[model samples]
Target: MGASGPAVLIAGPTASGKTALAVGLAAALGGEVINADSMQVYRELSILTARPTAAEMGGVPHHLFGHVAAGELYTVARWLADAEAALADVRARGRRPILVGGTGLYFSALVRGFSTVPAVPDAVRARWRERGAEIGPAGLHAILAERDPAMAARLRPTDPQRLLRALEVLEATGRSLADWQQETTRPLLGAGAWSGIVLTPDRTALRARIARRFAAMAAAGGLEEAARLDALGLDPVLPSMRAIGVPEMIAAARGDRSADDAVAAAITATRQYAKRQETWFRNQFSDWFRVDPLAGEGAALATALGHFGAGAGGAAG
Candidate 1:
């Protein structure tokens, strides 16, 4: 990434104002923001993903936000590739790069290196897809349990995609997915090249914020956005289709659920997702700087700047 200063990483649970903090940091440091969130990658899911609006971006350059189509498949490998290019470009332009998101895996891959799992052949993948469709996710997971018990035990029975992937990898290479994950390469963001922080708000306050923010999203044409995405007839297996609010909104749009009920379900789902994210950050990023949002953004900004050192306030691009 050239001879640039250390990059900044801002991670937190959903609805914890990660984007706002990212923008503020970028403004303070003359940095460009790069998205590390999975949901924010899809172009059709701005409202549901809570992606930053232009006004909220506040003139700082933002990359890898809403760049992928809903129907496209976006894997972590692809994200790493895109992120590496973005980081290099930002550094080459003499601007600090600030990566922000709730996706723990993205940060993990960036800082701790990504596993080089071999690609399953298309024929094998298609065969598994057919078998999964015929037997259902539970049945496929049962088969996975028989073939690769260690991998199967790690996956939920209801998660057909992972179950199928594990099954295909086992059949194709005779090795479990877990086995492949152990052999990882060098991290993209080497030591001394980056700084990271996790924002943790009070659980009660964060829950309240999640509920309120989701309600605001619904009121701000989130349902319409969901409906438009649904109309595209994308496969349910696509990562974009699995966005938190999309399924509930789709049910409401199809008359299978009331709009109010759908909104409630979506909010509950978001809260649950946020809780999982919080736990992940607690366990996985315990070493990074942790800020309590209850302490206010001023305090959080101070901590981030302190961690980033003298280059925290660089010239704007």
Candidate 2:
């Protein structure tokens, strides 16, 4: 551990047992868990986002999970600030902080820092949102490809929220989103202050877990949650609305698709999202310790404990 001590960062694809491992580590090290997942911040997205339940937390304190409303825009900057505060609070109490989730960008921003993009004018933002609503994500992505090819090449066409953001930034500042990202500020955690791990569970096993998890979600009131969110009549392009299972489950709730079909679609979408997450982790976290949770949770836990020089009955550092 450096002068700042060691905080554990656990990142992995969805359904990779990150939550369980985080809880286990927190319980062992007298630490608290801070959420890094983008969707899990929404209060209405518990089931679909696979947020840990109270029982799953095992009496270890968890922060920033389900703290924001679904209709609110929760940006990476906001999450970074919240996480920093949570980390400080944990350290102030002489407890380790364990940040865990599948959101690679969150981890990236925390470790590598992020530039604060100038806020777009309200009119400019509304205009881009209106265009997004009219053209849809694919059409918006096409427009981005024309205006900012470099940024477009980096973003997925199916992601409307990011597309709208990129278009708004370009129109508002006359610069590409990629250019803004390159002007990074100081990171929250300096080098050697934190130990990071990326879980790389076997794809076959992860896919099966995703399918089973979605099935469990559907049985555990996921449809009701989706219907409730849909009833709010929020913008479809909102981040919460774009969560993995929301669209399919909303369609099922509205009778546009059968429940079974919706579940299948949601499961497929989740698997695709997991693949993207895995790719991002592989590319961006190449230097971090890698653990395959599919092998055994004990081995993964042991590796993490080794990093902090902590035992099951001791605190990290």
Candidate 3:
């Protein structure tokens, strides 16, 4: 394997078989897997987040999975820094780095650079968090609408975390988050440094897969994971808590909702999230090679390997 050769990026929506494809490519190419999923970073909810199991890892070394505590706020900047280190480490060891996950922002930052948003002071963050708790997501969004309508219009009112972030940036830097986003640093992987693929499965088939996978998760300790996370009593607005299924599962575990109802809600949420992920990939990664992993992991792997073997350049499907 060439140490300086292009790193392979496998991105897809949930339940698209990204893990299997990545592990297969790693095994075939003398590579290692680096996580790019935001939810999979938490050490506390592996089952709920569907962090790949030990058996699923297929003896390939995986980096940055389940490494952070549930209570901490894990930012894109933090993930970018960790991914940079992981990439460098894998390359230094003469192994290919295969970054696989559904998080489009992570891939975008690595490939197209990230804006350096000024850090919020602890006091300023606390003040906004307090306001959020009192007024809720809609309230925070309304405040942002008043202060920075451009950023607010770009964000969903239901997303309290991002709304809070926008407010904090305005409070701390006296500038809108939109203004800060225009000042991006150099990309971690510039053109020709990495080859990427987006796994785009058929929507109907993907929805079925999402349903089946979540049902399997429910039967396989997902409730237990959610219960444990709830026991930690973390803030509801934290990213870990806001993971697709955690809140529903926690409700189920606490007897606030029946198990079946919780599972149904989670499945629905997961499908919705998958749709958003697909849209993001389609729009943002238009240049990357595309593969439908629903065709079978072997076929997907073969297609990706062929792309890589062909110098892994240009857009292809």
Candidate 4:
């Protein structure tokens, strides 16, 4: 909370203590915490998503957590609009807006603005899907390299979804995804109006924390939550259904796998997801403030406060 009114963004990999740090900062700076994590939006997923407990919020106001139904599709565009409104409301009340989460795309959309690419035609999409099914992702990626080298270079050959998207965008609009991205619209937080910090903790310690957190989730009725969500018969492709632990837990709940095996698989998947998040922040947010959680939580918050020029304050509303 710079006197000039800059929102604070706390981003990092999962199990890196981002939630604790964000809540502490919000309380100290008279700010409200806004969810930037895409997974945390689904109303049905509190435990598996690692959403903050009521007690853990520490009396600070929080927005956008567990607000969307698991059956609905929540996209980045919708999140940006919601976040803009949240920031406006928070600022109007004379409190800082602290956007915190592990999702890089949300932060990127906020700071760099959204790409206004046209929707791919359903026929074009279907064609690409059929091509992908016939030729496989690697082969499609090769075609993408020829049509959109810049986008292809950034995407993994094994990532069929992105590969298809890139190819479809090129075919439909005659523009690469990267090209569209370069022509961004107005960012929600304009230049110098926001500060961001990405927590960089030791990989080993983060993995261990992920394991412990998953175990805690199991003990905290995560299995029951998964059972309830699975019973809804939501589309497996939906973000909520693919949440880190939901699929594995659902498998166990359905007797497709043992509970112990599901837990282990979920823990492993979480670690893998954390690793991807870490890499993304490292690559995309190299200029943002970076602090090691192992160094200490207070130190990390102090660094953020220093960056934002926020003074000590009363409890957040």
Best by lDDT: 3
Q: In model 3, where do residues sit more than 4 Å from their true spots?
A: 1-4, 313-317
Instruction: Tell me the RMSD of model 2 versus the true structure.
Output: 2.9
TM-score of each prediction: 0.93, 0.94, 0.97, 0.85
Candidate 2 global lDDT: 0.89
RMSD of each: 3.2, 2.9, 1.5, 4.2
Q: Over the stretch 138-160, how does candidate 1's per-residue lDDT look in tens digits? A: 99988988888899999999888
Q: 1-317 in candidate 4: lDDT tens per residue?
A: 34525787888999898888888788887889999999999999999999999999988999999999999878788899899888888888889888999999999988888987898898998798788878988999899888778899999897776787788889999878898888887878777677778899988888889999999999899999999999998756467887888989999889999889999999999998998998899899888877776676487767666755644221110
lDDT of 2 by residue, 94-157 (tens): 8888899999989899888988999999999899899888889999999999999999998999
Cα lDDT computed for each candidate against the true fold? 0.86, 0.89, 0.91, 0.85
Clashing pairs in 2: none
Instruction: Name the runs in model 2 displaced over 4 angstroms.
Output: 1-4, 310-317
lDDT (Cα, tens digit) per residue for candidate 3, span 1-317: 25556788889999999999999999998999999999999999898889999999999999999999999999999999999999889998999888999999998998889999978999999999999999999999898999899999999999999999999999999999999999999989877678889999999999999999999999999999899999998889999999999999999999999999999999999999999999999898887788989896489989888877877643222
- Name model 1 segments beyond 4 Å from true: 1-4, 309-317
C-alpha positional error of residue 247 in candidate 3 after TM-score superposition, expressed in Å: 0.7
